[model samples]
Target: MPQRPLARALTALVAVLTAAVGAVAVPGAAQAAAAVNYVALGDSYSSGVGAGPYDLSTCLRSEKSYAPLWAAANRVTSFKFPACGGAVTSDVIDSQVSALSIGTTLVTITIGGNDAGFADVITSCRFGSTSSCTDAVNEAKAFATGELPGRLDRTYAAIRDRAPNARLIVLGYPRLFETGSCGLLAMSTYKRTILNEAADLLASVTAGRAAAAGATFADTRPYFAGHGVCAAAPWIRDVSGVIEAYHPNADGYRYGYLPALTAVTG
Candidate 1:
């Protein structure tokens, strides 16, 4: 894939300039036609880590990432995709400030997965016995219950301060559980339980936090609900798409984020 462009920042210069006194302007003397300035800020799930047709080398950014997909679908004019792999909530606080320019109309974030260390949970579930899966669920919940809110608060505050005017949308994690039905892999009962628990944690934490922030939180779990391990039309089919055990698939870009597009743009 082509070298990733410097993550674009939203800028409202046109609005500022046009409003200034004694500014000579176009004949229409009209407000500038503001195209949606969208910035996607988050981690691997947001970056489409394993969901690639494999194009870019650096940052391992996926071309099929929801950001590009949404942009094309909506005819978005300005877009910045800074989402990379391994982003924690703290990373969101650090990088998202300058990511927006001036006319930023929309922002979508998918983060907090790494904080849960979901990959390790999967490994423990896959390699260990039923008891290990129970341990994983508890450990995962500890993050969601104990740490997710704090991380979410910081992330929300940072985004709000950085792009106060944009319509921010927080996304929940996708359902990656395989409860004895995935044709791809006979995911152990423990493994499925852990995966579902992780998804639940992410959803509850993000949904509550985003609501507090007055941002839209799109819950994708429902979209993928019936399609879990036992369902025939599973939302996410790729194993590694689990990103060590429970993230979305390239199909997730379709299943998981389209609703986000509708919500944010609406």
Candidate 2:
């Protein structure tokens, strides 16, 4: 062979060998390096009701929501966000799962809150009497313990079926209130304790469902410990005129949920 041609061919062969060796050394390195097709599915928290500027009037999808924040920061090739303001698990199975596919590399969900009637509890407790508050809390606790696990399991299964290859991360709700009053005139200290425990229960049940479905669970309670509605620097709104009340704010998504997603997905 001519020397120049032979030398060029040798260099090309060496490059190919190096590429093959790299792929072999780090299994799934090529797949991992591929851009992630992410789909966000769930309810108010995922839709960014409290964390607005919203994308749609109904869906309430926010660019500042933790999923979008994570997607923007990461190598996301495509994104489909179907999370709405009051979506239950059934809503996800019917409406949002269509967004998922085998091509999806990641799916993050924050449902089951609406299914357990969490919003109704907040509303009834905030405006009604102490007895009404207790009743609402008790009802929510019942739903969380009895019905939520089954609902969650179904949602997880649906997502799994739609995106078998994707990594699912089930994010849970945070405790909405702190111990002391901190000028929250709605509920008493006793009520606060009950509500907080209910939130904890929701997280626990959701975590169990996620584990059963082979999905990762992100517990958000710790992230909002000192940043509850009554905290000095509250991440959740106490009672906003807009739809922002009780949900996480822009800062909450940035500081709280963002880190949790990053830690697990990375």
Candidate 3:
């Protein structure tokens, strides 16, 4: 072959090989584009307390949890699920905030329930009289209005400082029961109603704080309407069989929370 023809053939071969490599790289690049650096932070609801098959025993992170489900479905670039079973607002600051960074593109948090002593209120109501339930509910309500807002602001501000560019989604707790006869282990209808009202107050405060902090609040009450502890098919645990009672079940995370998050993100 002449020297010019030989050089042309080599150039053609290189072009063909380069095209093949480019073609092979397209899908991976697209996949990367579809993903983002996501960090999950919050409490038992975010950690999947009643939803079993935990990823970590200490944090009680379940594979079926809404955070993991959402991350997997959305195809996250990197997911750090630092949510724990009994995390309060301070817990997120002390433990979970370290997982976030300026590089994080997305974050979801479910906190403040513990800060209002929600579990203690429920426990007191469960074992004590109706008056005790009312008292607990009132106390929780006061805290939700007065103290919790500040705590939530601190947590949200910390998250903002850590992941300034990330889209933070703050998820609120669902109503724990419907207005009817609960099971024997459950609180009375009136008490359940009061507790649900308290949950509503908490959600309101949380949503307000989240908005103030430049985050979106995902209200889960509508999603959990008929699926509370007293429903025919309850999504929340009726009793304290697991580590944290009154938390969502696997079905709740799948059907209730996942859809709520999907709607918000979409």
Winner by TM-score: 2
Candidate 1 displacement at residue 22 in angstroms = 29
TM accuracy, model 3: 0.86
Query: What's the true lDDT of residue 192 in model 2?
Result: 81
Off by over 4 Å in 2: 1-32, 184-186
Worst 10-residue lDDT window for candidate 2 reads: 181-190
lDDT of all predictions: 0.73, 0.88, 0.90
Flag clash pairs in model 2: none
**Candidate 1 lDDT over residue span 28-80, tens digit each:** 35545556788999987778775676446444567787877888887777888
Superposed Cα deviation of residue 66, candidate 3 (Å): 0.6
Which ranges of candidate 3 are over 4 A from the true structure?
A: 1-35, 183-185, 240-242
* CA-only RMSD, every prediction: 13.6, 4.3, 5.6
TM-score, cand. 1:
0.79
Q: What is the clash tally of candidate 2? A: 0
Which sections of candidate 1 miss by over 4 Å? 1-33, 54-58, 178-185, 229-231, 237-245
The total number of steric clashes, by the backbone 3 Å criterion, in model 3 comes to 0
Count clashing residue pairs in model 1: 11
TM-score to true structure, per model: 0.79, 0.88, 0.86
